[model samples]
Target: MAPAGPDHGGSGTPEPDTGTQRRLARRLVALQSAHEFAEEIVLWPAVLRHCPAGDALVTTALEQERQLKRTLEELAHISPGSQEFTQCVNTLAGLNRTHLTYEENQVWPRLQDGLTARDTVRLARQWSGARRRAPTRPHPRLAARPVVLGTVGLAVAVVDRTRDGLTAR
Candidate 1:
């Protein structure tokens, strides 16, 4: 999670690519989106099935994720000198921090209770694999399912990687 303070260089502002701030923002968003996508695909189902109450929590979390994506998109378009951009960056950082802590506190324990040691390891591997192929940018319009994500993700990953290469990101 990003530190919830002044932009320690990852604000996704319209800064020059030569600087580390823009690159750091991209990397942070990429990793965050990848992990969240993995959890949505691999973890939520088991949680919903084994722990009935988890459905609501997962749903809320997913909505928050969508909002986060929208905020990111806004950030991408925002000028570096704009106050709105600064606020958006701070907001994104706070949301990420809160979501992660909430997941660790409320969701992790329930998932642990539902999954066995072997299941945990298996799911961990699956999660890792998903993250490897997941898109760096958010696709809020896409419904995040295993089949849809696995199929569309490949194409998106290709495009993202291509863009990353061109931009030297």
Candidate 2:
């Protein structure tokens, strides 16, 4: 059967060369990077300074970003139709959902309370700058599912080490 048109279901007729899967993957990477940059550089600092018990949440979110970076790296090379690609996408979706929930429910409120509009705008601009300078190519290690998972594990280990250092003092 032919693919359904937009009028038949959602928006419009899908284009054959719209590169939907590639676009989605690129968007996911952009969003993840933006969120990580916002939390690490802007939101976390404000939360740590203004919100009570913000440090733990910031630390947890940072670790989550670190892990996600590794996962993305691993999944970077897999084509969308492959079994490994499907599994990697599923894993990324679950992790992203969880992270979004935590940020929306727990972190956002704290940031809203602490950060002014001006502060947010300034931070957003900084994030945009960082993203512009970020590498465009996918990490080489992400050529297969096993590598992706292994990279995520390594990132988690690094996060753990960082967390330990933070907690040590």
Q: Rate the local accuracy (lDDT) of all candidates.
A: 0.75, 0.62
Q: Count clashes in each candidate, considering only residues at least 3 apart in sequence or on different chains.
A: 0, 3
lDDT of 1 at 142: 73
Candidate 1 residue-wise lDDT, 9-76, digit = tens: 55454434434545666776677767777877787776787665988878877887888877776766
Q: What is the C-alpha RMSD, rounded to one decimal, of candidate 1?
A: 7.6
In candidate 2, which residue pairs get closer than 3 Å at backbone N, Cα or C atoms, i.e. clash? Answer: 6-12, 74-142, 74-148
Model 2 misplacement above 4 A: 1-23, 137-169
TM-score of each: 0.81, 0.60
